[model samples]
Target: MSDTNVNPQITDAVTQANVKVVGDAPAIAMGNLYQAAAKSTGILFQNATGTQQQGALAEASTNQGVMQIYAMDTAADAATQVKVAETGVADNLTGLLTVLESFKDKGNP
Candidate 1:
């Protein structure tokens, strides 16, 4: 009978596959890490943008309130001026009536 021996081909193939996987592991891990970092940075920028918009809205609301107060103050001042002008007109009318009454009395006498 001839001696029989097992071929080492299958074992060699498995070893090469394992070596390839091990050699590529670092690159794969680094790629995954970079992806994660990009996602994190994107989230951070989105939050910052939201915060800025909120701040701008708050500022606009505050400015609107200030404008309303200014308008009210201006209206009050105008009302005061109108009241003063009406009082002056009433005083002038009264003085004119007194002078006309005196002139009529002197003419009748």
Candidate 2:
């Protein structure tokens, strides 16, 4: 007979999932939403800065259309600068990067 070992967590997860509807995380839906919003806002703003920069770069040589874009660009730039200067954000980002680098996909065959 051919030998193959199924991953234990996959089996356990299936069993537990079938037995239980959901976990504590799912039971508190609004709390999860607030948590997600709090956690993701920073990441989203980081990305949004890049997107806004690209958009501004695209419209660099344009005529004065609306002041809204200019105000947004200025605010975003100031916020990022403040975030960089405020606390241990650099160290936190470095730690996150290191953790990501350390993740080796052993499951990939």
Q: Compared with the true structure, what per-residue lDDT tens digits does model 2 show for residues 1-109?
A: 8898989999999989876765654768878898899889989999999999988977874635555556567877889989877767788899887877667444423
Candidate 1: C-alpha lDDT: 0.93
- lDDT (Cα, tens digit) per residue for candidate 1, span 5-91: 757998889999999999999999999999999999999999999999999999999999999887787877899999898789779
- Candidates' TM-scores? 0.61, 0.23
**Model number with the top TM-score:** 1
For model 1, the superposed segments whose C-alpha errors exceed 4 Å read: 1-6, 74-109
Query: What's the C-alpha lDDT at position 45 in model 1?
Result: 100
Candidate 2 has its poorest 10 consecutive residues by lDDT at 100-109
The lDDT of each candidate is 0.93, 0.79
Clashing pairs in 2: none
What number of clashing residue pairs does each candidate have, in the order they appear?
Answer: 0, 0
